[model samples]
Target: MEGKLRLAKKNLNISLKQKPASFQTSSPELTEMLGMKLAKWIKKHRVGCVVFLGPFGSGKTTMIRGVIKGLTGLNNITSPSFTIVNQYAKGKMNVYHFDFYRIKNATELESFGFSEYIDSGLLLIEWPEVAMEKIPPKSLKVTMEFLGLKRRKITIGFI
Candidate 1:
């Protein structure tokens, strides 16, 4: 099992050291599969937080949908853009998805108990560049950028 986990991490382009892992995906399905791969790791490792940085219309939400689907086996997922945050639950775990684009400052997070939320369950945040400093240093940071019309380069590693 350990060996398989290691292999999965490697194939998924995830690095634990200063060297970040990066890969390119041409389709949303591939991106979602990568999200699912990340889901397995986070669940097994009990990783509490993951932050996604990318431009608007990027695959952040799509990838998150994959994570939610993988974590809960619930295929229906939506962006928490206007809603701010969305919660999904499985047998014994919960996933909190937060979108911070509309917020003016990271301070707003404090009002909603964002810090406490991190400890409650797995958190997947989008448009977190503004809140980067507030995010825990131990959390995972994922950056996705466009490389072409339909291709995106994704890098994953610790914050």
Candidate 2:
């Protein structure tokens, strides 16, 4: 895990260097496929930080469910909304999912000690609006916007 984390820590990981990809997803399955595709880009020897910005019922959890499954073959991934943080791992590879919907600002988020783990594990943050600047420069930012009742325009890039 440390070796993998070290790779992204240096900003040399291939995922960080990816071209921006946009998806028009109207179904949960498609959204999850996008995440699964993302999982393949995160090489075995590299860690990652992904920030998700979207409204409620925007398929964030579904996408994360796929990412977790693709990354570690985990089948169950509940949103960490109330729990704040949820941890999952397969062997030495660890993934931490964090929800900041309840957080009000960067100062409040700092108390969670999230930044401490940014340098190591695969950290995925939902509702990270308040801590954008606090995240790593190489971090991937996924922004989801409503296009219709069941459609969303998701943009992925390094921010």
Compute each candidate's TM-score over C-alphas.
Answer: 0.87, 0.83
Among these predictions, the greatest TM-score belongs to 1
Q: Report the lDDT tens digits of candidate 1 across residue range 25-135.
A: 777877787788889878876788999999986799988988899999998799999998999999987999999888777678677667777688888999886677778
Each model's number of backbone clashes?
0, 0
TM-score of 1: 0.87
Q: Give residue 19's error in model 1 in angstroms.
A: 1.7
Off by over 4 Å in 2: 1-19, 44-47
lDDT agreement with native, every candidate = 0.82, 0.78
Clashing pairs in 2: none
- Candidate 1 Cα RMSD after full superposition onto the native fold (Å): 4.7
Per-residue CA lDDT of candidate 2, range 66-146, in tens?
788889999889989899999998997799998989898878888877778877789888988887878877788788888
